[model samples]
Target: MGSGESTTRKVSFGVDDEDRVRILRGIKLSEDVLQRMRGVANIPPESSSSRQQTILKDELAKMAEREREAAREELVKTMSRERQQARKEAEKAKELAQQLQKKDSQLKALDAFYKEQLAQLEQRVRHSHMFHRPAETCLNVKNQSRNTAPVCPGLQAQILSCYKDNKDQTLNCSDLVKEYMQCINAAKKLFCLLINSEYDLNCISIAVSM
Candidate 1:
């Protein structure tokens, strides 16, 4: 019996040893898996800092792009305003030029009208002088032959003097012009009557001689 008990105790001891071995192996495998997981979770400091820097650079680039877009929009608006102002100024200049051209045309037309009036006045004065000289010569010859006073000589001199004094303003001599015209008509009528009477006298003398 003593031998059998000892043998059983030895067998039981062997079985406990095997179970301990298996539990130790299982713990070791779990520790290895935990170590691998820790290694994967831990990152290098340089790599972390580099990633942060890359993200910061990307943010700064985006900000810069936004700023550039804003500046472009502002420039476009400013250019548009400048174009509009230039167009308005050009229109104003065109209008002013048109007005100046119109005024110039009016001045030229007025100048032409004044020149025409002056030319007509000069022509009338020349014709009056021609008619007056012939009438004066005839009146003088008739007066000498008839043994009579000169006709309207004083009035003729006065009219000529008035015309010379008021050359550019001939209307100032209107009163003198009317009086001189009346004197000339009377002289013409007197000359015609004298010519008719002389012709009758000559005819009577010719009959007597026959």
Candidate 2:
């Protein structure tokens, strides 16, 4: 190369002052590169991605509703079981109360029946005691204070026969005993004779009244 001659080569791309001459001669951008640059500038919004997000949200909501329904169903089943148990308990209590009332009524009836029987038995005993006192037997025996004789079997037999014939009276033994006592006192001397004669008659009247 001769002294003072140029040696720098000029280029278009990446051009500095050495390549500036080549760039001025002819420098054009490629169509494919220009299209890629325009695509970057006009990027579309993420509308499809937003739609997917909305679909996912709807599915989650449906799932939440299903969970709530399941939970409500379980709660209803639990409450129904509790209510049924309570109803059974209430019925049992009511039955127990009725049984107790029945028992009380039966006891009261039995008590009243027993009391009636007792009263009847007492009345019979009083009547028998009043009518069957011993008499003084006066035989000519030495050093005899008073020979107390037991009730005559024949007289008692007659009286028993009379009572048996008329044994349906409501009168108690006390009433007949009181009447017979007064009769005996009024006829003290002939008391035994009168008693033996009217044993059946008096006893029958007493039994009928009783």
Candidate 3:
């Protein structure tokens, strides 16, 4: 046939036709196609065979539906498990944050206590006449002592005067002893404060170490 030319063939169902010629001309034909041709030729449907095909199609549809349902259930289970794990992780993070905050509060308290002790020490040293020497003389004497050299008489006199003040106020005859006593007292007070603190020391210690 030419590209633009339409070809028509006459056919009769009962006799051999162009379709039969095509089927006979080395063309493969399926059973379904043959059955459809037979139906077009007025062949009767086989009850048993038709029913069996219908049943097979229904079974396949049902199996497909079951497979889809199973996949959906698996997806739901996976999502639920992930949600639970996420919730647990979030809870853990919240607990860790709370613990960190508590530790920060404890450290602040410790710093405050140290500042109070230092302020008290500074006050005591500043107010004392005997232990109080001019800044320049004190620095010179301290440097001379470090070099193992003799200090000036004026510097020595101021040091001696400060030493007498230290002795008069100290436990025995030394400012070192008085400082020790003050430190001891401060330590005792700090222990009491730690005990009364809201958070326990053990927990704070662990957080700081980590």
Greater TM-score among 1 and 2 belongs to 1
Q: Which candidate achieves the best lDDT against the true structure?
A: 1
- How does each model score on TM-score? 0.38, 0.34, 0.35
Q: Order of all candidates by TM-score, from best down to worst?
A: 1, 3, 2
Q: In model 1, which residue pairs have backbone atoms overlapping below 3 Å?
A: none
Error of 3 at 178 (Å): 15
Question: Which candidate number would show the highest TM-score if scored against the true structure?
Answer: 1
Q: Candidate 2 at residue 141, lDDT?
A: 28
Q: Across residues 1-210, which tens digit of lDDT does each residue of candidate 1 receive?
A: 655654332211111442221332222334445446446543435678889999999999999999999999999999999999999999999999999999888866755654464455445445543333323333334423334455566765776686677665545666765665566556555554454544344334423332
* lDDT order of candidates, top first: 1, 2, 3
Better of 2 and 3 by lDDT: 2
- Go through the candidates in order and give the clash count of each: 0, 4, 1
TM-score of 1: 0.38
- Candidate 1 lowest-lDDT run of ten: 7-16
Please, what's the RMSD in Å of model 2?
16.2
